[model samples]
Target: MTNRADLHTLTGAYATDSLDDAERAQFEEHIGQCPACAQEVRELSATAARLGLAAAVVPRPALKEQVLRSIATVRQEAPRTEPGPPGGTVPRAPLRRASRWALAACLAAATAFGATAVWQHREAGDARDQAREVQQRTEELASLLAAPDARTRTAKLAGGARATVVVSEGRDRAAFLATGMAEPPRGKVYQLWFNDKGTMRSAGLMDPERTTSALVMKGRVGEATGMGVTVEPAGGSPEPTTKPVALLDFPA
Candidate 1:
């Protein structure tokens, strides 16, 4: 019996109809209750259909004629001479037609399988890219904390949760790390801003559900003298919609 993980991997093959009878039965049973698997199968099937349509092309007149002429020159296999029960020897024309049908079926299966593999590869690549981006951000935060000119300041939010910002003028970057953050009001998220003297520029929005987060700010430190956090509507606004819950001033 295949485990759920193994069964999940069969989605691509199942979409392509490349699975054998037993495996297909197992997968069909699995998909009946697995919404994720069913959704993936639907998407892959649609992709395969588009790929088939895109790959379609009419054969050139000369190529068609050449293939027909070449077929006459090809030698056909001899039919069996052994005596059969009642019908005797099977006719050669039907055997030839059967072989052609088999070849066409094999080609179709190959095409579908190829489409599945390509779709899977693209999904894996996107996952890898997201992972790479996360790793890069983590590294930047680490470097900012280690900078010789780095200065840190901490401020308490409305609910006693502490938010810390590390600003490094030499690195021209700042990082914000906080834990124990309380969830904002419904349909709201926490937004960060860089205070350039009296001017406040948007930094980025924090994931409201996360109690702990570490991130490098969006823009350069430049002339920004302070930072603040505020609760804003989901997706955030161009300007702060509420007073800051926390504020930190960069060390001189």
Candidate 2:
């Protein structure tokens, strides 16, 4: 049919067996070749089937009596009239009402499905981005570790802990490793900073839960005079909040 929207609207009625014989035959033929319509019909049918199963509860004896009493109190409404030939049978209004309700329910189900699908797609994209970041970091760390000119310097902290920093001046990169240092106080984190000449800049933050860990520092090591670690508030700070616990000068 040229009117795809009209044909598509028949899906819910067909799934619920609420369509007339002529309408049902037309949709059946259309669904056979229309993959999108076929898939929509399948999902709607499954949702309808689940609702049917859930509605199969045995009613209490009092429920039937209560319903009958409620029906007795309600006034019977007359159906709307439409133009038709004399002696012709008019379409049942209750059937039309049932089909409308069924279509509305199916539309709601389709909307919910669409929202969930969009959320899942976004979640998958975020996961892929995170994976890519991790892979890049791993490769950078490996390259720094394998550099032939890499040299290490060590500094002893106040609490007898040690911080070792590896650098490759040729590659303009560095990696920091800490050991035997107690975790920072609650609401605080350990952050790494690099000093280039007299200018100080943040490198990265250490994992708070980790007592011993290594991280490949960010930023070019151009004219870097030293590396230092400081305790700062959780999530780290733009500037060092306190003096370094350990500072190691790079070899000239």
For candidate 1, list the clashing residue pairs, or say none: none
TM-score between candidate 2 and the true structure: 0.47
| Model 1 clash number | 0
Evaluate model 2: give its lDDT: 0.65
Clashes of each: 0, 0
Those runs of model 1 whose alpha carbons end farther than 4 Å from true positions after fitting are 1-127
Q: CA lDDT of each candidate? A: 0.67, 0.65
Model 1: per-residue lDDT, tens digit, 1-252? 776656766666787788899999999999998786686666555434422321222334565576689789989898664554475544433433333333333333332232222333367788577546655554555455545567777667667676777788889998776756788889999999999997889999886766566677888989999998889999988988898888889877
> Which 10-residue window of candidate 2 scores lowest in summed lDDT?
49-58
Assess every candidate by TM-score: 0.49, 0.47
Best by lDDT: 1
Q: In candidate 2, which residue ranges exceed 4 Å CA deviation? A: 1-133
Candidate 2 per-residue lDDT, tens place, 58-106, comes to: 4346655766887979898996756865876444444333444455444
